[model samples]
Target: MSEVPQARRTCRRCVLPESPPDITMDSEGLCSVCLEAQSSKPQPEEELLESDFTRLLGKHRGKQKHDCLVMCSGGKDSTASLYYMRKRYHLNPLAFTFDHGFETEGALRNVHKAVEKLDVDFLFYRSTFMRDMFAKIVTSGSGAILCHLCSMWYMQVALDIAARYDIPLVIAGWTKGQSAHQGTPSNGAGQAGNREYASMSEATRRFLATLKQDPKYRDFPQSMEEVLKRARRRHKAIVLSPHWFLDTHPDEYVELIRRELDWEYPDLSYPAKSTNCSLNFLAMHLSLKHYGYTHYHVEQSKLIRANQQTREEALKDLEFNCPREFLASLAGRLGIELPE
Candidate 1:
């Protein structure tokens, strides 16, 4: 196991630590997951290009005023995606954002700025529908990952909105490390078959299995798989991300958004410089306490393994800088006492 200080033992070669059955460390300090990956010969897919994005957009273009429904988080990746859709690809996109009552003021402001600068139709959905569920997870000490739940909710919302508007493409801000597709949370966090999310996903599934028994959440979808399955029956919309097609580094896009959209980073976030929700603090703390690392750790570690990021940078970004008292306060808002 790595002796490094991350408030837990981590793999020597990667940031992920000894979250057993899913992640484990050998005598050499390397993680078991990495070991398995090393032994397997995996095939790499073709790198997506701007032309590919253009071609895909062309397939659904002129069908409506908006060619795609851009899931703008008001973050750099999403803002840049909106910019590219408007300026580079010359495709009209319906900018969409949703807040389940935990969004930061800066994130919302960033979204508004990007939408205004792009001159596109914007749709903002704010609701506290999931607030009770969040509270239930905390108060009951459920093992479900908050981000996974939120992604499933928002993805269903995005698909519903796309279907209603007759738009055919759903644009997301996800990078390569974030997920394989928008249907799953970052890096298959809700995908039970994904070995990377093995233990984590199982816990989420268990919690969801129990959550489904409740009359309040009885109709809730069990997984991202279920959400996507239902959407496929009604919507022909295709989900994609600009970052996947573009080879541009995040730093470059951050600069572009800063100049064009007048974008600024959120003052508070789990991973530095990224725009995430306030509930993310509670999620991070719980994930760390329960699983030893958050999904951000998994994403950054993937980036490092892919040579897109360094371990040093990933560590710094995933470091828990918040005080325990503040995290407890966040839980208090949800009407629960944070576990020690």
Candidate 2:
């Protein structure tokens, strides 16, 4: 009895696996995405400097009770953002965490330590509103990306929190790959025009379309574009990431947070070395079952292209090493049984 083989073919230039809905490999083992990226006209890049970040902070500082609303996911990127907001930049930020019942204890612990050490105000919102939606994605086999929908929901929540506090800036721990221009759409709509996000965005849109038929989820924004529109009507806040303006790498900041804030990595996560929620294990498994790859592949590929990380390093981190029993445990929580 031999074990079943997983999809192993991948693009030579990036970590994208050979998947049909969006990716195809050439004879040379390069993917269509890589080829198109190579041929596309390079857009003029905006160089963000530390001075720009300082200036922006100064302008927004002391305008309200808090200078900014920092979204802390208990991940290294976000935890570091919270640390910097209070200590390095000298801004009084309101630390916000949204738990859809899938957040890991490790992540929450990191957040708890950071807020206590920094002595900043903290807001923790936990709800089951998204639990049904996530379960639907799994049972219905909608092939929708869970992370995309989750991001949309949380982004809206973050915007509302910022507005309630009259904060001018909604800060995120997004790396260079996740950062978008301020005042743009929240869930990667600004990047929809880019070739890399086109297919994935379309898939997410199609899944959201189906949601409109359900009475409970009918009002769900169909796209990040729509999310931004609603946000503008309710409140105006600029979304920013300190990582976009700072040249510091995760290696540098991970150490900083560990030493200064007592932040530690989680025991379990996909693609290795990341600090994702417990639900992320299920999400990555389903994503691979449907799309042959996950959003992490897209993010790491971008980092490789930007020279922030090497292809070899990204490849190593992108490996799917989750054990069967661990996945079953996560699925058991969702009341779904994994296929034998």
Best by TM-score: 1
Q: Compared with the true structure, what per-residue lDDT tens digits does model 1 show for residues 210-230?
A: 887788888878877778888
Q: Name the 10 consecutive residues with the lowest summed lDDT in model 1.
A: 180-189
- Cα RMSD of predicted structure 1: 3.1
TM-score per candidate, chains pooled: 0.93, 0.91
Weakest ten-residue segment in model 2 by summed lDDT: 180-189
As for candidate 2, its clashing pairs are none
Off-target runs (Cα >4 Å) in candidate 2 are 1-8, 180-193
Tell me how many clashing residue pairs each candidate has: 0, 0
* Shift in Å, residue 166, candidate 2: 1.3
Q: Give the alpha carbon lDDT tens digit for every residue of 1-340 in model 2.
A: 1121366588888888787756788999998778887888866778889898999899989979999999999999999999999999999999999999889898899999999999999999998787777878877877677788888888888988988889899999987646532222236535645554555566667778888898889888776667767888877898989998888978999999999999999987766988888888788887777777777888787677667788999978877777878877777777777655
Give the Cα-based TM-score of candidate 1 against the true structure: 0.93
Q: lDDT for every model?
A: 0.81, 0.81
